[model samples]
Structure formats: structure tokens, C-alpha cells
Target: MYQTKTKREKIKLFLIILIPILITQVSMYGMTLFDTIMSGRAGAADLAGVAIGSSIWVPVSMGIVGILMALSPIVAQMVGAKQDQDVPYTVQQGIWLSITIGVIVSILGFIFIDPILSFMDLEPRVQHVAKYYLISIGTGIIPMFVYNLIRCYIDALGQTRISMFIILLSLPLNIVFNYVFIFGKLGLPAFGGIGAGIASSLTYWIALGLSVWIVHVVRPFRKHHIFRSWSKPSFKSWISLLKIGVPIGFSIFFEVSIFSAVTLFMSVYSTYTIAAHQAAINFASLLYMIPLSIAMTLTIVIGFEIGAKRISDAKHYAYMGILSGMFISIFAGAILYIFDDPVARLYATNPEVIELTKHFLFYAIFFQFADGIGAPIQGVLRGYKDVNITFWMSLVSYWIIGLPSGWLLANYTNMEAYGYWLGLIIGLAAGAIALFTRMYYLQHSLQKKLDTQQS
Candidate 1:
């Protein structure tokens, strides 16, 4: 739909936002990456502790952050519609929402931590270490969400360089601090895996401080006066955000929790199978951050266009995003498929692990196409404030279609882990089709409205 020039400009704009966001995400993604590695280094118990802590924390933490993601479209729309005055109120409400949820999550996190760990029936030492790690990181939930709110606000305004720079700066800082605390370097007592949590909590404080200072002191944010006046929580505004956010949060939860469940079910498999599965997933997720960054940018851009009532342009840009993501994913998938050997070898030296990783990686590559396609569809849909549909789609595809079929094939049949990946392939592809089809219909209907209005 976009003319060559228009497409080029959108792509350029996409890159401008995408590159910084990519950097920001890569840096942000590294925190978890480093956490996992550091925990592995600490000891087997420490590693299990950190892994369990992550499984419990990540989904809930992501839910809180997902709720705040409504801020992106809200702020971007205000920017696009030139409703500058409304931006502050929307963002302020987001801040209130973040703090409230953060506090609730932190408290709930502490209270539920024991029961959840106990439910898993993990090793006693692993459970003991997991609780301390969680409690340590849990204390920073408020700051973490607050920082996310601030980041979303400015990012929606299309200024990502600052956040990217801050995150890039934070990565090395987190790594150094992680090293110091985990290893007891520089006079600090070694906390081992617990130390990563301590260091992570400290990082959030630093991020929050820098973020608030930038908003208060920076010229870009000063004009908007984001923090100028404190806005009390309004039931009406809160509801509006929740309307958009709750579905997105649960949608993500469904995707993550189902996969988490699959990992548990994988306990029946050999250690090699477990290692291969983890390696494949880790590799896929790292690559996924690429499309994920673009999708995040699209949520802002498409939302801005929608807010401005440039429906056709919105559609054009949306399509462009989807196309670009798919094109790039081809390369990513190819790289993974082509180099499966070296990559699998790097994950482990065991012949069995390496061989299983090779097979898993083969299956993983099949989903990259769907993931590439799905990420942007979700992003563009976000810009249009269409989220509930995705929740339903994900539920049906992953649970009803994918998980059921996989469980049957894996357990009911002899396919084992292969059945799971096969089911995942089917599910992710189904989700991609369902989401993209919905977007198409919405775009066509909007185009018809514009045509009718002109006539």
C-alpha cells in the first residue's frame, strides 16, 4: 500500500526507532542472560535456585509491566493527535498504576514465594536459595515498574536514545556489580546467587533515580511537564488502561506459562533432552528480541497514526512492519538452521546433548517464521488498541490446539519432546494466521470507512 518513497521513509523511521530500541532491548535482555550465567557459576543449588526464582518472578513481573504497556499507545496517540496536554495525565495515571501494582506484586511475591516453591517439590537447598533470591529481587519491584512507566512514556514520544544509553550503561554496571557481589570481589561478602538479586535490586534503584532526574531536568521532558503536577488515581482512567492492559498481560502469561508447563512436562525426558530444549529456547528468544524491538516500535508508530486518524497510512506502515519482520526472520532462521552444529556444540560438549540440541534447533527454526510474523501483527494491533482478541487467539492456539495435541503426542504417543515442538510449530503458525487475518479485516474495514467518509 505504501509508495516506494513512503515505504522508504517508514523504514527509515522504523530504523531510527528500531536501532535504539534494539540496543535498549539487547541491553535489557542481557540482565537476565547474565543472571542465568552467574547463577550457573555459583553452584548447582544456586543455579536451580535462580532458575526457580526466575520462573516464579518473570511471569508476574512481566504482567505488571504489560499492564503499563498501555502507556505506549496512550502517550503515542496523544503525541500523534497533538493532544500534548493529555499526555501528562495519562502517564501520571500510569505511574500510579505501576506503584500500586508493584507494591501488590511485591507483597504477593513474598507471601506466595514459599507456597509456589513448595508446590514444585524442588530440592530443599534449591528451595531455600530460591526464596532469598526472590526476596532480594522482589524488594525492587516498585522501582522496576516505575522505571518501565517512565521508559514507556518517553519512548512513546519517540525519544529512545536516552533510555538505550541508560540501559547500555546499566548492563556493564550490572555485570560488574553482579561479579563483585556474586564472587565477593571488592570487599563485599559473597552472596552467590542471592548476590545477583542484590545487584539487580541496586540496578533498579539506579535506573529509577536516573530516569526521574532526566524527566525533571531534561529539556525534552521538561516541556511536557510529566512530573509537573501529581495526578491522583482516578477510577475512570485506571479502568481505561486496565481495559487495554489486562488482556495483553494475560495473553503474554498464557504464552509464557504454557511453555513453562511444557518444561515441567519435559522432566520425563533425558537430561540431554532438557539441555537441548533449553538451548533451543534460549537461542530462539535471543533472536526474537530483534522482531520484538520492531514490534514495540510499531505499537508506538501505528498508534500515533491511528490517533491522528491516518487510517490508510496506519495500515501501510503496519504491513511494512510485518513484511520487514518476516524478511529479517528468514535470515535469522537460516543462520540458526545453517549453523545448528556449532551452536549446539557451544551449548554443551556431551554428544547426546549436542545431537538433541541439533534436532530441537531444527524444530525451533520452523517457528521463527511464525514468530517473526506474529510479533509485528501483535505490535500493529497494539497501536490500534486491539488486544483482547490476541488473548483469546493465544489461548486457543497454545492451550486448546498446541498444548493438547503436544501432550497427546508426547505422552500418548512415542514422539516425546519432538511431539511438543511439532505441536508448537502448529500452534505458533496458527496464531500467526489468526492474528494476521484479523488485522487484515480490521484494516480493510477501516479503509472502507475512510472511503465512505470521503464519498
Candidate 2:
């Protein structure tokens, strides 16, 4: 029997694992803030354009990223099973697959940018800006996909510190690029929102290059020969990846589509309302990276533990990760609530925008708790290879319940923006409940299998 860890040992392990995750999240939020700040300064139209462009762009990109993310759990399982020699081949397959998908997505995004912008009914200026941003950013899809593949491989190897290190090193360069590109500094023409997009594209490629160098040429992973020839993509590996990844992709797509749809629906409101909504969302999303990173880490950890057949330990780690997320979110929510005004003011100057944003901030604070709880639970479920339930739950919660509720509340009720926020809260709550229930059932099933085998 495995020995139970002492409380101190548990705490130490948690801290050691959690700190890099926290740093990585903070770095991601820093990047978001940089984007927002540069876009906001470009002009309100530019800000609105980036917001809308990202609403669509992020979901599509994340959907593919979710598919690529299947590599982590699969790799983790291999690692846990002491099949380390196969890791490089798996990583290479993921790299090739992600690049192929990225090319297709890039083509679609470039071709449909104008159509999507027109459909959103953005103001004429906002539409033009958004179109430019989308086109420019679309060029970076391959780099983004490559970066995620590298990140997943590194993370699955339990070297999350590399991601953190890269982010820290790149952030300063990103800020410099943003400043030069956005402001026409050093003889560059001012491209406004397009400049921000260009900077983002360049930054992604730079980061990808650095990551590749680190993984391939650096001391540790260099020995692994990540670039070495692997058995060409097998039908078996592709099927395995698809079986695990499609559900995860759909789950994330469902949740993200609801938000994108909501944003589109809200455009029916005045521009001020949409701006307020975007600002509030920007802040909330920044905070959300914390739980998101933690959830991703837990997914890796739990998958590794389960692959080793340490069933109880896997369950314990997942629960502990959830508890840690909840505690941190509570404190984060309180801080956000207290500083709501300052946060809103940072993004917008209009009194109306500020007022609406404050209301959004209030709701956002409470929503974070549900978000924190839900993300890690889903992560654990994904780690357990139980993504089918996640897909079903997300479809039910977001499409069937969340989207309709938001539309009805926004259109029919006296509370317009608040109604949408309420819908989001309800959706998150439902998602949290469903994910937790699924996780519980998975753990119970695993325990039964273990018992039966022992008997």
C-alpha cells in the first residue's frame, strides 16, 4: 500500500507545484493587459475591434488548442507507465498534427474575416479595424499552434518552469514591440489596432522559436531528439488522439461559443454598452487565467497519477487542487470587488462606460468562484479521459441553458447588461455542478475497478 503523505509534505508539494502555475498565469494576464492597454490607447474603435475580433478568434484558436491539448494526458500516461522513450515520437506527431490544423484554420480565418466582421454589425470604423487585426493575426496561427504543442510536451514532462521562464523572458520584448508598432516609434508607420495585432503575431513566432531552441538545443530535452524521425503518423495514433481530443475540443468550443454568441448579441446594444461589456470581460478573463493554469496543471498531474494506477492518490490530488482553486478565487473575488472602480477606470474614461463596467465588475467577482471550481473539475475529468461527459454537460449547460437565458434576459428584462451577467453566472454554476458530478462518478468507477481486480 502507498503511504499517506503527511500534511506538511502535502503542503510542500502543493506549493512547489502551484507556484510555477501561478507565475505562468500572471505572465499570461500581463500579456492580456499589454494588449488591452495598447489597443485602448490606439482608439476606442480599435479597442472595440480587438475585443470583437478576439471574441471570435480566441474561441476558434482555443478549440484547436483543446484538440492539441490531448497530447498532455496521453504523454503523461506514457510517462507514468515508464514508456519515456516513446515521448519524442508522440511530441513529433502532435507537432505535425497541430501544424496541419493550424494551416486549415488560418485559411478559414483569413477568408472569412470580412464576412464575420460584417455579420457582427460592428460600427463601420470598428469593422475596418477588426478586419485588419484579424488578417494580420491570422498569419500567426502556425506559430501559435507550434507554441502550444511545445508547451504541452514540456508541461507533460513536468517541466512547467520552462513555460514560466520563457514567458518572463519574452514579456519585456513583447512590450517593446507593442510600443514600437502601436505608436509609430522608430520610423514605423502607426497601424493602430493592426499594429497591436502585428506585434502579437511577431511575439508568438518569437516565443515559438525560443521554445523550439530550448526544447531541441538546450541541455535536458536536447538529448531526447524531439526532431528525430518517428514512425509516420499512424491511423491508430490519430484515432486515439481524436477519440480523446474531439470531446475536449467540443467541450471548450461549447463554452466559448456561448460567450462569443453573447458578445455578438450584445452588439445590438449601444457601442458604449458593448465597450463596457468588453472591459469587464477583459478584467474577468485576466483573473480567470489563474484557475485555468491550475486546472491545466491538475489535469497533467491526475493523468500521470492515474496512469501509474495510483487511483486514490489521483483522486486526492484532484480534490486538493479544486479546494486550492476555490480558496484562491474567494480572495481574488473580494479584491476585485473592492477595486472595481479603479479597474474599470483603467480601461475606459466615459462615465456611462465606467458605470456599466462597475456593475459588470460586481457580478464578475461572484462569477469567478464558480469559474474557479468548474475549470479544475473539468480538468480532472479530462485527465481521467472522461471528456465525453464534459462535452455533453457543456452542450447542455451553455447552449441549452446559458445562451437562451442570456438572450431572454437581455431582451425581455429591465436589466440588460446585468441580465447577461446573470445568465453567465447561472451557466457557470450548472457547469460546475455537472463537472463535479462527473468527476465523482469517474473516481467511484475507478475504485470499483481496482477493488474487483484485487478480489
Candidate 3:
């Protein structure tokens, strides 16, 4: 029953999915750059403090988002199967689940901010600044998670344009707020790092509110009572989502933890080294959003196809998505390679930091290509609901190989800062290879199953 889409149709679908992802990621990257520029203007201490605070915040937040991603594939499948009525209930269940998890994370994050900063052994000034940053930003966790819930639902329904529009609208506001709070501009008190945190918190909620209003009250999707109905939580639906989501969350956590751990380890180096590391890492993060967006979109698409029982078409779309991602990433990596110096200079004025960051930029370039190759592959596997294998593969790649190798290289070898980045490259390479292997086998098996059933 697989509908073999024409080349024109496939290309149109790919572009439709790709463009919004590109726009959304570019907007987010711009916002990150704006935040860095604002913090850098404040002082090196402020920049470093915000960087550390974000290192802690990003992993946990992404893990929560990952859990919510479980909803996307389910919704996509439902839509593909043309079970339109059930879509709203599934979306509602996802929102409730994300809210519950967000509350727990926010409470724990607020309670442990100080102790965790102490554990990181930050310099006194950095510690003081980070404490303020954490408290202010931690308060926004609920809204942040809530936003993701809405985002996942929209994305599942193939309505990513709204998310892109929201990011574009919110970004300038975030910049303006950061400028006002970080520098005492427009007769506002300079809240320094705390102000930056406050700006992020406020804008996050504003974006969430706007997204909700658009999806629930706007022209097209407004008729759905899923947004208006405050139905009692369904234990069965929650458990189903959780069963699919937790492994996915832990898998994301495992990957992000490697990066977080590297940032923490880099803190032991000189301030110059740390700043350089942050600059390189920041650029890498921006580059990563490209393939990440593609991966997510591909997951939604493949989920829909599979749910329609078009296994062969699902596999084809998955391959096409991964190929497109790889080619784009290769081009992006080349651009990074060529523009590394100018990019680093955009972030920091210090000569030594810029020079050091240039060295690490090479590593970032390599990793970007690897990520482009790997991310969509993993995403396709997720579309197939082959998540448990994906989990084990990530654990083996990151923990078994990445962490120990990084520790040995950074501390035992003479590599130091370079070792930290090298470890990342190695981990990503391992992950890419493993994911590709898994996708190949899974795709083959899926096709064989389809063939047998057809025969």
C-alpha cells in the first residue's frame, strides 16, 4: 500500500520541511550570538558566568524536550493513518506530561543551583554571577517546557511555520531586553548576568503565550478543543508516552552530557582557554542546529509514512533526508573551515582567545560533518520506534568510548584543551558510524518485512 511519491513531490516535501527548520535554527543562532555579544560587552567575567550557567541549563532543558519528542512520532503516525480526531487527545496528553516534568525539574534546579555551582568550583566572581543567573533562568523552566510541548505538537502536525514565525518575532525582543538589562540602557538598571537571565525568562514565556494563542485561537487550528478542554489526565496515555519518551530522554541526556562534561572540564583551564573553548563551542552549537532541525523534521515525516504502512516510502524518505543533511552539512563545514577566524573575532576581541579558538574551530568543522551524517540517521531510527537500540548505541558510543577517552586524553596526555575537543570529535565519529550501521540494518529489515507481508 506504499504510495511511491514522484520526484517532484518528494523534493517539494523536503523543501517544505527544510526551509522552516533552517529559518528557525538561524533565528536561534542569531539569538545566541546576541546574548554572547551582550554578555561580552558587560565583561569577561559576565561572559564566562553566563556560559557556565547555560552549560548546566541546556542539557537538562534539552532532555526534557527530548521526552516531549516522543509525542511527535506518535502524532505523525496518527495523522498518517488519518485518525484526525485522536490527534488532539494525544497532543493534550503530551502537554500535561511535559508540564509535570517541567515542574519537577524547575523545583530541583532552583533548590540545587548554589550547591551545584559550588561543586563546579567556579572562581568566586564567576560563582557569584552564576548564582544570580541560575536563580533567574531556573524560574523560567516551566514555561520553557510548556513551549516545547506546544512546539512538538505543532511540528507533529507538520505546522512548523508557526514555530519559525514565533522565533523570528521573539528574537528581536530578546535582544532588546538583553541590551537594556545587561548594559543599563534606556534608563534601566544594569542587572548584568542576572538581567540576561531575566530577559531570557520573560521572552520565553512571551513566545510560549504567542504560540498558544496562535495555535488555539487563530484561524485554522482554533476549532480543536484540545487546547480549550481542561480534561482530567489520562493515566494510560501518560504511561504510553512515558514508556516511549524516557529512553529517548536518557538518550538525549547521554549525548548532551558529553558536551556538558567537556565544558565543565574546560573550566579547569586558564580563563583565556575557557573563553576560547566557549567561542569555538558556541559556533559549533550554532552549526549543529542545522542537522538537528533536519533530523527532527525527517523523524516526523518518516513517522507519518510508517504509520500509513508505507514502510518502503518511509525508508526512502529517511534516506533522502539523511543525504540532504549530509550534503548541506559538508558545505557548512567548509564554510566554517574558511571563516573560522572571522567567526571567532565576531564573539571576542581578545587576540589570544581568538587565536586559541581558531585551533579548535578545525575540530568543530570535522564534528559538524559527522553530526550531519549521523543525526538524521538516528532520527530515522527513532521514526521506526527502534528507540531502545538507539539508546544502547548512544550509551556505548558516548559513555563507553567518549568519556573515558576524553578523560585519558585531557589529563593523561599533553593535549589539555585540545584533548577536550578531540574527544568530542572522536565521540561524534563513533556515534555517526554506529547510527549509520543501525539505520542500514533496520531499513533492510523493515523492507524485508514489508516484502514478506506483501508476498
Candidate 4:
């Protein structure tokens, strides 16, 4: 039977999930923040190289991460429905999916990475380092995806604290690795921008190794007998995961690629422009973690309700999550807007980079509302196994509306960097509206059906 949770109880549960996930995300981004700070210290060219290379790597890797993320809701629902026996088999299938996709992507990313960098309009020096950075990191793609698959399984089991602690551990370890490789500390050779990539590669591996140890040794996971037997890859299981996963992957791809595309467009300007763009966007992403973590938790929470055959309860708590996200956005936006200058100073030392980031930050601040609203709604919908509409909606909002407008404004008008950010505002807003509308309609439709069944 589905256990009923009070409204206050739901909010409390949301907080329990939100804080650890937030720390985990913060720790995850802490790695990037460290890389960005270190890159800035290296040189403008080093910073730009990392930014450009990240533009390529982040989106490509996110596509795989997004697809694998489908595992969260699936596993959450299964656990909720008391199909605990299926969890281990489901994990095996996820591993198979990760390995299959990981091998292909890692190979292609390595072969094509240099050629792609060669075509970009980067400063030759920046291009050279960016190519090295991509290659250094590209080799670790499979391990990273496998780690994410592991993370999904653990988080679905309400063991979020495990992922949080592991990421926290990786932060200091990554810094040490970066120090040794990037600065020739501790008898290591200085690799500069490439060193950060190498550090991240090593960090993912370390974290993965630790995760395996924790799962095997920890008392909680041993109960599942998750590793007692390995299941062969099944085509049917692949199709099942892919059906829900592909759209999610594409949706994230569209969103992240558009942002990455803007970074490429920024390259047309001075190196400082791109560096400043990187700083502002990275800071914006930090604030975005609030809603994003909340969104991730909503999937598990609402999926649990759905699996327990509590549609109304799922819908109720889903709104609570969405509202919480919006509330947090208001505070986060205010903080960014009010303290923009000091925050920009944290990423860069140059006056021009600082000023430019300050100006562009307005759009980033304004869009948080839309991002917050859209993000959690989509998370709830994912729990309901609804993704196709989101994929199509994102394509329209980001590609059709956001990127083109950004390009036109940055190129044709005097907006330049400012224009691209303005386009971000519009794109985020459209996505928010579309998602909200879809959820509203679906909720009422489900309500009517439930009412009829009762009658």
C-alpha cells in the first residue's frame, strides 16, 4: 500500500533529499570551479582553452549522462513498487548500456576531437591547448559514464549521502592531482591546461573505485546481493531504457549544446570575452544547482508515489517540489544580481573580464526563474515517464528560438555577448511555459480519469 505523506512531511522529505544532492552537485561543480580558478591562474589562453574544450566535452558527455539518468526514475519506481528483486537486474542492464555507449562515444570523441578543435575560430595557442585538453579528458569518458551509472543506482536507493560523500572526497583529491600535474609539484611535469583534464580523468576513476568499495563493503548495499550474478546484455532491455532515455538525452543535449554553441560564438570576440563568458556562465551554473538538485530529487520522490499507485499524491508533491524550486530561484537570483561584481571578481582578475561578466549576468539572473520552473516540472514529468514532449519542446525553445536569436543578435546587432545572453532569457522562458502547460494539462487529465474510475 502507498503510504500517505502530509504536505509538511513532503516538504521535509524534499529537504532531506535536497541538501545532500546539493552538496553532491556543489562538490561536482567544485571540481570545475577549481579547474576554472586554476586555469585562470595559468593564463588567459589556458582559461580560454579549458572553456572551449569544456564546451565540446560537457555537452557530448551530458548526452550520455542524460540517457543514463532515466535509470533513476525506473529504479525508484521499482523500489517503490517493492520489486526489489528487479533492481539488481536493472543495474546490470544499465551497465551494459553505459559500456556500449561509452565505448563508441569515447572513441569518436578522441578521433574527432582534434579535427573539431581545428575548425573552431580559436586563437592558435588556445586551439592547441584545447585539443590537448580534450584528448586528455576524452579517454576517461567510459569510466565517467560507468561512475554515473553507479551513482544512479545508489541515489535511487535513497543512499544519496553516499554519492555526496564520494564527490566531496574527489574535490580535494582532484586539486592535489591538478597541482602535481599542472604545476610540476611533487616531482610531476607541468602540463598546464591539459593537466586539469588529466586531473578530472583521474578523479572520476578514483571516485568510481571508491564507489565500488562502498557498495560492496557497506552494510546497506550488501543486502541487495547486487553483484551476486551478472546478467547478459539484452536487446529488449536496451530498447526499453532507450525509449525513455533517448529523448532525455536529446533534451539535455539541445539545452547544453545551445549554451556551448554560444561559447563557440563568443570565440569570435576577444579571448577576454570568452573567458568572461566562461566565468559568468559557470557562476550561473552554480546557482542553477539549487533547482537542479531539487529536480533530481523530485524524480525519486514522485516516482515513488507513482509506483505506489498514488497519482494524486505524486501530483501534489510534485507541485511542492516545483514551488520550492521557484522560491529558491527568487533568492538565488537576488543574490547574484545584488552581488554580481564581487562574484565576478572571484573567477577573473582582469577589469574588462570582470565588467563584461557583470553586464552579462543580468540575463543569467533573470532566467533563473524560468530555469527553476521548467527544471522541476520536467523532473516530475520524467517520473511519470513523459519525455518526448520535453525533447521536442526543448528543440523548439532552445534551437528554434534561443540559438538563432542569439546568433542574429550577436552577429547583426550591437548586442554581441549581451545579445547571446538575451536570447538565453527568451529560450529559458519558452521552455518554462511549455513544460508548465504540459504538466497542467496532464495533471487535470489524470485527475478526471481517476475521478471517473472512482465514480
Residue-by-residue lDDT tens digits, candidate 2, 88-138: 878887887888888888778768877777777779888877788778778
Taken over the whole model, the C-alpha lDDT of each candidate is 0.81, 0.81, 0.81, 0.86
Task: List model 3 lDDT by residue over 1-455, tens digit each.
Answer: 12347867776786787678678877866766677667766776777887787788878888888888898898888888988788778888888887899888878987888778888867887777778887887777788788888877777777788889998998999999898888888988887766788888888888889888888776446656667766778889999988778778878888888887888887887766776777788778887888888888888888888999887778778888888888988888898889988988876788887898899898888878888988888788778877888888888888888877888898989887788777777888898899999888988998898888889
lDDT score at residue 49, model 3, on the 0-100 scale: 81
Writing each residue's lDDT as its tens digit, candidate 4 over 107-172 gives 788679777887878898899878888888877788889889889888887788899999988889
CA lDDT for candidate 4 = 0.86
Off by over 4 Å in 1: 1-5, 267-276, 341-359
For candidate 1, write residues 273-303 as lDDT tens digits: 6556766666777788888888888998898
Q: State the weakest 10-residue window (summed lDDT) of model 4.
A: 1-10
TM-score of each: 0.92, 0.96, 0.96, 0.97
Kindly give the stretch of ten consecutive residues in candidate 1 with the minimal lDDT sum.
Answer: 1-10
Q: Model 1: which residue pairs collide?
A: none
lDDT of 4 at 97: 92
Ranking by lDDT: 4, 2, 1, 3
What would the C-alpha RMSD of candidate 2 be, to one decimal place? 2.0
For model 4 the local lDDT of residue 233 reads 91
Those runs of model 2 whose alpha carbons end farther than 4 Å from true positions after fitting are 1-7
User: Of models 1 and 2, which has the larger TM-score?
Assistant: 2
